[model samples]
Target: MTDTTTARKPPTSKNSEVHVKKRRLPDETGIFIVLVAVLLVFSILSPNFRTIDNGFTLLVNGTVIGFLALGQTFVLLTGGIDLSTGANIAMSGVLVALVMQAGVPWPAAMLIALIAATSLGVLNGLLIHYVRIPPFIATFSTQGVALAIPLIITGANSIQVRDIGFSWIGQGRIAGVPLPVLLLLVAAVIAGLWLRMTRQGVHVYALGGNKNAARLAGVNIARTTILVYAISGFCGGMGGMIVTSRLMVGFPATGTGNELFYSIAAAVVGGISLFGGVGTVLGAMIGAVLIAAVSNGMNVLSVQSYWQSLVIGVIILVGVSFDTLRRSRAGRPVFAKRPAVDTPSLPPSTTPSKS
Candidate 1:
């Protein structure tokens, strides 16, 4: 007689090995495609759109907005918004003009303007981080204050810039490229590299991704917040200076409403998430280019200004909607429909008879 015995293996837990299928992260490919499409459409619609002079005009017009957008990207990545950027530009221009008129050297005046603008940014950060004010409300209040300072200082008047040296920053060209455009490119490159290649940049993304988690992970939230806003102010101030240089005048209302709208639009359209923690400076620059292209194309086509505004509004809505969708999808599991694989069972064993 022989006896047969078999041992069964215990079933593995479903959670024992989580096979998470890796999905590609959302990128700025959609925006880039839109940009290319817009370019092609405009080129086909208007014969003058491809001309060099028109191209220069588009780039020049885009410079100020590009600078503001760059700064906006930094703030947005930190899960914050700055409505005061335009005011900073206005205030900085006004202050620089007033200082220059008072016999200060152009360089010194520019420095003072930058310092003032950066100070306002610092104030915004302090208000948001230390005082616990909401980013929107805080920046909005600061915008009013910033705009008022310029209005009060210049009595809502324009100050003509006679200093030729200062004007060169906006109008001069190096190797056939406009100075302002070149500056924008340099700044964009620096910002993009910093965001992609540095530890601080990672912290900004991490902070925006989850504030509490970032805090637990040792991110210096307060400093990062302050730096973010300060950079915005600095960029705004630089933009104001460039505008003043280009126009040969510094008006109390230089940037006005256009500043806030265009800057935010550029960043948003460039694929920066309003909810924060996702975007690139290069993308923001491309967004600025797209905006400039649209405006230029509309002008060439003789479209009404009001219609242009409507179009811009539509673009913003579309960009934001896309961002929302991308974010939502990113949050969902990639293997939601993955098929289960059954664990193999052990075969029964036949024992030899002990006869």
Candidate 2:
């Protein structure tokens, strides 16, 4: 005779197995692919769009937007926006020219203008952090001030830049590449590295991700806010300088055009979420290139300016709408959710019967 016995197996714990999700490609990847596709399409559509010279022109034209978008990336990462960027450009350009016209060296004038523009950024920070003002109200109020200051100072007239050396910033080329494009590339690399490698950069992300959580994590909210806005201001100053240099004149109307829209659109399109805490500088740069290409391509095809504006407007809506949808669903699937790692089920175990 034999007795049969069976042993029951213990329940498997969910924590026993680790689910390491596959590494995601950088957020910039999709945008980069899109950019490549755009370039290809435009190249096919117009022979003018395929020329190396036109390629350089695209980069040169996009430089100002790229600079503004870089700064906007920092600000957006902190869940803030600066509508004053365009105005800051006008202000800094006018101030630098006015200073140079007043017998100051161009370099010195540029420095002063940068300082002034940066100070405005600091003001935005102070108001938002200490004064308890909303980012929109704060930046919009300052935008009006910035726009008016340049107009008021210049008496609504353009200021001529007599210093030929200053033109190098915008017009000069090295190794056949435009100076502005090179400067933008260098700045983008540094900005990307800083965001990925620095402590403050992490804080910027944390703040944007969840402000109260970031605060509890010992992130200095005030400083991060101020720093981002200040960066935005500095970028604006750089844009102003480049444009002023290119034109050899500081016009109050310089950045008052579609620049502000293009920069914001570029930032959002490049993968910087409008809801914040989800973007990269590299992505923003890609977006800038895409925007520049679209604009340039339109011009190559002789599309009207109004049509260009309409296309940009549509792009902005699409980008922001997608961002908003993502934020609303946070960690859940909206359009396409973050890919999930499948956890395999464990088979049941049993002891052999004794006979």
Candidate 3:
């Protein structure tokens, strides 16, 4: 009998293999170049911008918001938006403060805060997935819930966190890095791996690329969408806790209107499409870093606080405009490349063709 198995062929063309490899480096390098240019421009503009102290300070101050933006990355990748992140942050802080004040141990208080935040996420997932409410509407409603809970609990006052040990997660630094920054790194790594390597990652991309196609391909669209929003809420809660710790207090009015930037700016700058399906963890981080740099540079230059908002708004508008232009030039879907179509094996000729 003839052997049925055939030898697997290696990629024959070096050019094809090299072309495949070349793609990996460029996605991030473009962003990196832009970041470097921004840094260079600002350093030249302000002597204080290049100082190590200023850099560390920027990292410390923006760490919590940056972490929240990472979660926003996940939701945005799946073509969903989470408007509730700012609210979640406030609510989580309030929940943590209340538990601690109620004589709960610091660890227990922390756990309670996480649970409260995650519960809010779960609720967002339920509304979006089960109720079939649009993501924008669902998250917007949850945003109200997140904001309201904090006000109800704290009554518009800031609650001080007296336990130093409990505050360490937000305030403590190891080996010269801020604890919040470390947490941000950890969150980024975890998110990056999930979005890059796992089956769920592929599913998320597929869902964003084409919901009907994902469903036809047996990807669980509902589950993935729910999970992404849940993650967004979790990040908000964690960010809230960190901010509370850093300030040593949970203020009800904190993070108001800040969610717009955290969710919108980071994602947009990081190359996450407003229409969804294309983004990366590193890109999101870079975007957050860019925003942080701009804000920090403004501070170093002694620009008025009002001007800071206007600058940030202008940056966002420009970023969005760039993305629009890029999309228009391409004039096709961003991730449209695919493997070659397979040809069916020919059946044995029962009768010779009369060519």
Candidate 4:
């Protein structure tokens, strides 16, 4: 006290105390809440909406496109689009149906059908990865091809599958759960685990976040891109098989307008950004189920079919808008900007902080 000595404090490092708050996981939470709200509303409006029969029907019908959305999730994770999913489904359905009629065993028929579908997917991948074509153009071109192939094979007709064994896989229930739904659930679990806990999953997100950075990080961008599309094709094939079993027929018209619903709805509502780099498999499944629920509810309520389409379109817009907003916020990091390079020169020692 008598000497009036003061100790100087060392400068604090800005990096040590970042004070960043944890962010909420994508808009999927909101979608889930909305789904619950929708179900409640529909149940209140139409008592039939809560019926067990309606529930089972919804599960069966939703399984086909639900699986397609799983593939869409993969493609979108790699910042890619697959416009041919619907067409792929149609082609697979027709192929399987026609093959089953040719005295081929059901399992063998499915193998051939899946191979054909994967080939189409491989073509898309090659065009996008090797030929350097934009994914949009590549998939769209393949979409036309997918649509044409089924027509060519079936001559614009439907091929019915009378095989009871094959039909059971599509419609059978185990402990009251439809087989298709069970398959979808299993696929979801596998896809979710792959994306969340595997190296390839990390690579997919990294590539979507920044392709150059991902490549620099030793991620095989081209291969991942190719694989994502191939996976999408495989999902379509599986969905097609389910559809064939459900109807006991495979028509060239199978899955028409489905690509629009599965891709747009699942990707957007599941928090899979259009700009890429974000999504979850569980979220995609939830999104698909929500859309399916809405459609089913509308049917129960006797709402016009066109009105349902309009509602779905609006939901798509809302989802895409939310995704864009979330991505923008996520990219705005606390330390995103560089510090100022030129600090003002201090005046010749303002009393030099004497000790």
Clash count of each predicted structure: 0, 0, 0, 0
Residue clash pairs of candidate 1: none
Clashing pairs in 4: none
Query: For model 2, what is the alpha-carbon lDDT of residue 128?
Result: 93
Model 3's number of clashes is 0
lDDT of 1 by residue, 27-108 (tens): 6766777778888999999889999989999999889999999999999988899999998888999889889899998999
Using all chains and alpha carbons, the TM-scores for the candidates as numbered come to 0.84, 0.85, 0.85, 0.84
Residue 250 shift from truth in candidate 2, angstroms: 0.7
Q: In model 3, which runs have C-alpha deviations exceeding 4 angstroms?
A: 1-25, 317-355
Name the TM-score of candidate 2: 0.85
lDDT of 3 at 46: 90
Evaluate all candidate structures by whole-model CA lDDT and list the values in order.
0.85, 0.85, 0.77, 0.80
Kindly provide the TM-score of model 3 when superposed on the true structure, using C-alpha atoms. Answer: 0.85
Query: Which wins on lDDT, candidate 2 or candidate 4?
Result: 2
Tens digit of lDDT per residue, candidate 3, span 237-270? Answer: 7888888887889888777865566557866777
Instruction: Looking at model 1, report the run of 10 residues with the lowest lDDT sum.
Output: 334-343
Q: Please give the TM-score that candidate 4 achieves against the real structure.
A: 0.84
Question: RMSD for each model, in Å, please?
Answer: 11.8, 10.0, 8.1, 9.2
Tens-place lDDT per residue, model 2, 1-355, is: 5545667688876665433332334556656766787799989999999999999999999999999999999998878899999999999999999999999988888899999989989999999999999999999999999999988887899999998888999999999899999999999999999988988888888888778777766788899999999999999999999999999999998898888888988998887867678788988998898889889999999998789888766655665565545444445333232111122334455545579
Question: How does residue 221 of candidate 2 score in lDDT?
Answer: 89
